[model samples]
Target: VERMESISRVNSSDHVAACQRSNVIISLIDEKLKYRDSRAKDFSAKCQGLKFLPFVTKPAGFSLNWKGNYFKMATMFSAAELYTVEHQDVVCLLKPILNENSPSFKGCGSISLAVKDFLGLIRKPTINLVLNQLKEVANYCEDITLYQENITNACYKFLLEAMTQNEANKVMITAELKDCSFILVENTYVDAAKVAFHLNFEAAPYIYPLPNKYKNNFRELFESVGVKRTFAVEDFAKVLESIRQDSESKQLTENNFQLCRRIISEGIWG
Candidate 1:
């Protein structure tokens, strides 16, 4: 019984030591994991194009003999190349570094503008591909939703404008400026009439007398003329709120779906 008791005590001591070692290992691993996660987050935040750095550096170079024009050209060319590849990661990275306050960001606006013009050259089919790629990058970055939205809107607008212009200038131009189309009246009819009377009695075209009551009604009349009416501020706010809610719901559904898929794949559902 004495020998048995001694052996049991030794075994218990070994178990305790093993547990302590296991805990130490786990703590070390947790620390390493946390450091890795922090580094990853930091990296994602700053991942912009590498080419802009040299141009920014040149102005501040020890020689102090840098040509701004050459720097601008180089940066513009780099931006054009990046834009062609639809490298939004580079663009996002470039934004903060090129800000007005940043020493290196001086020529950034020019580079950015060049990139924007380059993006204008992208065809419709390629625009969607670039947008999806940007979305994936934005999702991974997580905090760039505003940037993503801007990029998406810019791409969409560019495409819309390009398509509209192309259609308008087509060889078989079927586009018509239909009657009742909204026209911008610079001044009130009375003001226009007075100006006309001052300039030439008969040279001015007949100006319709706009009533004071009809000033507010002009917007309604404009709409009646086939001009697409935009939502009022309040209505637009509600529309945006609805869209936000829908997006949140969709994201939740996607997360749930992913979780279920993972569980099934691991045989946890069985």
Candidate 2:
């Protein structure tokens, strides 16, 4: 009977906690919806005349480049930093005691309870959930690219079949003269059209006649498949600006040297 009563009490407490968690999540969602609605007008204005792909979705996570390395939003915060009481000092203080028999400790609640609550908060569907959504969007982009490539190849094969045997013979005699001409014209038109349509498009002024050694060096430097072939001066400036901003935000400056010293000192003493 005692065991049954204990189990029942435990179940009831769990049900209450679940209800509380549900309420908190619902409240957060409500606030998010209200904020979203308030920004709807501004968002719509910014999206004017933009024909967004119907299948592509916005990534939920913010992108960050740290020390010349790109990292996902969730991974930016270190595990130790995430559990540190400095970030959620109040929550650490208010967390319910996990066991009455535990020894007292400085800084926050019992170490085990603090760790548990920290992990729980991290696991919750907060802003980090947006990162998962972004990964899905990236996958969708890859799928679309593959589909487009297949369509392009199919169209090329269909056009190849349209030529007669006599025309094919003529093309072979002139080293595929008709095929070469068609390809050249199509490429020129597409390149011109792309430049006209896209403001960011900038064609290379001249194809560099690189020596074999130089070509090999270039290939060795940039062997990644998906890396962009070229970058504009403006793009380089933007990257520099991003690095400056990130450094400034992190206070990695002479003025913050003392702060770092203090942190190091604390670690040593602890």
Candidate 3:
């Protein structure tokens, strides 16, 4: 009996030691899982883009910069998305960035269209302000029903009819546009697609380093819009040079030069 008791005690000691090691391993695994979860959350937040803040009244100061192109591009994209949500007229606001001599060109002295769209003129609500106004619209137009009723313009009659479809359709659309109540406010002075285009173009140099799937999706956004899938600026001088060198060009008269120039310009710019 004495020998049996001693052996039992030894066995119990070994079992306790094994349990202690198991506990330690379990704690390490738990910590690793928690760290992985935290990292995932941080990456997700970064990818979701910037959240704009609402302003009660126009502030006395505003500024935006090109630091951290990823987040900056996301924030600008959010602003542009908000602008589109409001269904504002985009035609009058868009000016060709290549046309530097035009009076309406807003690039200051730089040729970068991204700079012009984001910086904008002092008088206009720039991209930063557009982001702020997105929040303002969210704050004021919380109730989609009431917001829809307030649409009084004759031109927006079709839009209103679309908004008031069957209950299920209305619910779906309201769910989509609920965050874009600012679309008709006439606040943005730049085209949303152009803003998206130039910003994406500027960020192109950095995009190759990203994962293949992410890079593909980032590029696909522009294609989903009517814009083509290229960020390259065609050289008009090169086109002219090619035309001059063409054998068929020798018979062309100078009177047709203006017409040819207009057609070539349309082919390139349009």
Candidate 4:
């Protein structure tokens, strides 16, 4: 009974803490302010006209890379992508965590969680879960080789298929696909939040910033994937915090510098 009570307390407090954090994110939005995209109606029309496959779903979890000049969206899709995850960037991130002797992360929650969450997506996979991750291998356009419209067109096709098609039709579309049609582009920043009210169906957005917003909601986004990154990111945060504390203490000695170097190197380079 004591153990059960302790478990219950942890769960209850975790729930409350999670709710408080969500409230902080939502509170940033003004209820009276809705995103108004002038081109949304026209964009929706163009989106509807794309030659989409039968069941390819709309892009969720959209990411922004402004310097790349092309916004990249992970075409999070069904298991059509089988042989690609190995070649993607997970190697650079996952390898260090899995290292058995790494003091920073050997038996850490981040390593276990990352293995549990990401390793299985490439191993045995499933599609029924909420926000199921598929692949990160997008054909990146270094320049404006593919016009912005083409990528957006694919997104619209995904939207239409996601909203309009039934399960049966979606299954049939897969059989009709000639190749991974997404070989043309990675993702586009179509502003899922800005155009939410204008989508054909009642679509819930994954990650897109509201228009005319004063600041980018970077902190809120970290919250979205906190479960996966909590272990890893917390370690990174601790290093920075240690450095700040050391600096404040006026202890800018060689020993402190070496400690910082070890923290940085052992955390990532191990």
Per-candidate alpha-carbon RMSD to the true structure: 28.2, 26.3, 25.7, 27.3
Winner on TM-score between 2 and 3 is 3
Q: Could you tell me which residue pairs clash in candidate 4?
A: 73-187
> Highest lDDT, which number?
1
* lDDT assessment of candidate 4: 0.28
Q: After superposition, how far is residue 213 of candidate 3 from its true place, in Å?
A: 19
lDDT of each: 0.30, 0.27, 0.29, 0.28
TM-score for each predicted model, relative to the true structure: 0.21, 0.14, 0.16, 0.17
RMSD of 3: 25.7
TM-score of 4: 0.17
Per-residue lDDT, model 3, residue 37, is: 51
Model 3 lDDT-worst window of ten: 90-99
In candidate 1, which residue ranges exceed 4 Å CA deviation? Answer: 1-144, 167-270
Report the alpha-carbon TM-score of model 2 versus the true structure. 0.14
Model 1 CA lDDT for position 73: 28
Query: How accurate locally is residue 86 in candidate 4, as Cα lDDT from 0 to 100?
Result: 31
Q: How many clashes (backbone atoms < 3 Å, residues ≥3 apart in a chain or on different chains) does model 3 have?
A: 1
